[model samples]
Target: MSEIGATPDPGEIKDKIKAGSDRANALKAYVDTVSIKHVHRQDIEMIDLVVKTYELLTEIMKLVESKVDEIGNAKK
Candidate 1:
């Protein structure tokens, strides 16, 4: 939420990005640990799907960071 007509802050946006990345990483780790402990024949596909999804999210976050840097440089 922003005050009306308030300009967005890149620093704040970067902080948010960092936080999201951290959470994604934490979830990925937890999933990996849990899967290792409890993987089953019927659940393998679901686990793989979840792990791949997190991998995609991580890659997307990296791309977002790159784009932010690219845009900021262009603005300068």
Candidate 2:
């Protein structure tokens, strides 16, 4: 735990988010390559939802990294 008035580390935050993004990307790859012999309508819908969610997550990750960079710049 950080002490009172301690500033949080932006690098640590970015690293953690990047790690999660990497895992998400790996799962996306699996989703892209998995073979479904008999894909149902529901399966298709779910896959579509996942793809959209991933796109949004990608945007969010970019936003976070941008914010981190901004903070670092402000500190400099």
Stretches of candidate 1 off by over 4 Å are 1-7, 35-38
Kindly give the stretch of ten consecutive residues in candidate 1 with the minimal lDDT sum: 1-10
Q: What is the RMSD, in Å, between candidate 2 and the native fold over all Cα?
A: 2.0
Query: Per-residue alpha-carbon lDDT of model 2 for 1-76, expressed as tens digits?
Result: 4467887688887888899899889879978985677888788789889889988999999999899889988999
TM-score of each: 0.73, 0.85
What lDDT does each candidate get?
A: 0.77, 0.85
Clashing pairs in 1: none
